[model samples]
Target: MPSHRPRRLVAALVACSAALLLAACAPTVALNPAADANDPRCADVIVHLPDTVADKTKRETNAQATGAWGDPAVVLLRCGVAPIGPTAKPCITVNGIDWVLENDPASPSLRYITFGRIPATEVVIAHGKNGVTDAAVLPALADAIGAIPQQKQQKCLDTSDVTSPTGTPTAAPPATSTPTPTPTPTN
Candidate 1:
């Protein structure tokens, strides 16, 4: 009986050591929940999240309305964030959606926010091997972001789009091309 007890004790210690080692090997991602995390639009986006981002595998995170990617979590996205108002950030339209790039020199990663989107979304990525991570991520995330209804203030006007200040779309001007007449040869 004494010999059996010692054997059990030794086995238990070995199991505990192995468990601790495995836990340490796992990746960690720490992020905070957005204030508007409970928005239904955010829930829809979360459910539709991609399995990966920028070639890095998506990993589970503790933050609400958030998604993570990479073992060390190179990319992090948070939905339902407060709308950005009149920032000097450079904005660009992608896949019919406008995005604002907030380039902070003090930060190691770049930040991107969907322009004119309600319950706005923000993505931060550690600069990847290729210089452009936003180009890879924004396209994949466009539809999900577009699902959220846009506020009137959030609408972007493309120069190609013909619309009045009253918000009604107007017909675009006809293309102007001069008709070239061929001269008849005299016999």
Candidate 2:
């Protein structure tokens, strides 16, 4: 019986050790809440238009303009009209294009919209990748810009699968009608 007791004790210790090893190997999990899907604060951006798009003749003028703003970290040109929120201000206009400036100094949170302008030369600054931009605030900017008789909102890119390169066909399911049965009267 004493011999049996020692064996049982040894087996129990091995089982406990195995359980502890498995627990240590378990994957870690994050307990924090998921990020917000509709955060407006995420949108903030600034737009800078270069003189080339503005069509200034002299190279000195272009250099002066470029030097005036210093070198922006990220720039996107000739995309679409970025929307602007109420808080934003029209900072400057060069060659008929309006540039909106934002107050964020740490990093830009603004996006520029090319609106199909030719010879693309525009600069954009925003906080992080996928940061806020005039394009990001376009819904609100649309209403304000709409007040101008000449300005109209451009249609967004077609997101439908029809434009997909794969050309894969998707067939609609055939419709079926259920047959109605007449109830027999109980005798």
Candidate 3:
């Protein structure tokens, strides 16, 4: 019994050390939540996030509804951002979700914010690392981001859908038909 106790203690110590080492390898990512971070819809988006995105494994984040991937965090996602209206910034639809591109000339990262979705989501992808591209990163997160429903009035549109100056849709004029000549009365 004495010999068995020593063996059991040694096994337990080994397991604890291995766990600590693994935990140390993955550090918690610090992120600031959006203004509407407390929105319940954000929870839905967070839960649906994939374990791996763009070949980068998901990292634990300190803030609610926030996600980070890759050792240096090439992709970062935050839900519950302020929803945006129609904008000139390019908007693209991926996997049934629409994302509005936000470009900053000086920044190396590409930022995308979900358009038309209530409690919008924002994803930032830093380029020149992990061979990540907008094509790959956006689609990977589309499923989780799609959890937020898009508001019809705020949806993205092409030039053809642009409204007139008065803000109403430009519709074609009503068709006019030639009237038949009236019969002349006899004098």
Query: What TM-score do all the candidates reach, one by one?
Result: 0.65, 0.21, 0.77
| Residues 61-177 of candidate 1: C-alpha lDDT, one tens digit per residue | 888889988877778889988888766567777787787878873566888887777789998878745433667877877777777766776654455554558687889999879
Model 2 alpha-carbon drift over 4 Å, by segment: 1-74, 85-90, 103-122, 125-187
Which residue window of length 10 is worst by lDDT in model 3? Answer: 127-136
- Pick by lDDT: which candidate is best? 3
Query: Which pairs of residues have clashing backbones in candidate 1?
Result: 116-154
Of candidates 3 and 2, the better by TM-score: 3
Clashes of each: 1, 20, 0
On a 0 to 100 scale, what is the lDDT of residue 111 in model 3?
A: 92
lDDT for each residue of candidate 3 in 105-136, tens digit (9 for 90 to 100): 34678999998898999999988745477887
- At residue 114, what lDDT does model 3 achieve? 94
Candidate number with the higher lDDT (2 or 3): 3
Q: In candidate 3, how many clashes are counted?
A: 0
Alpha carbon deviation, residue 150, candidate 1 (Å): 2.4
Error of 2 at 121 (Å): 11
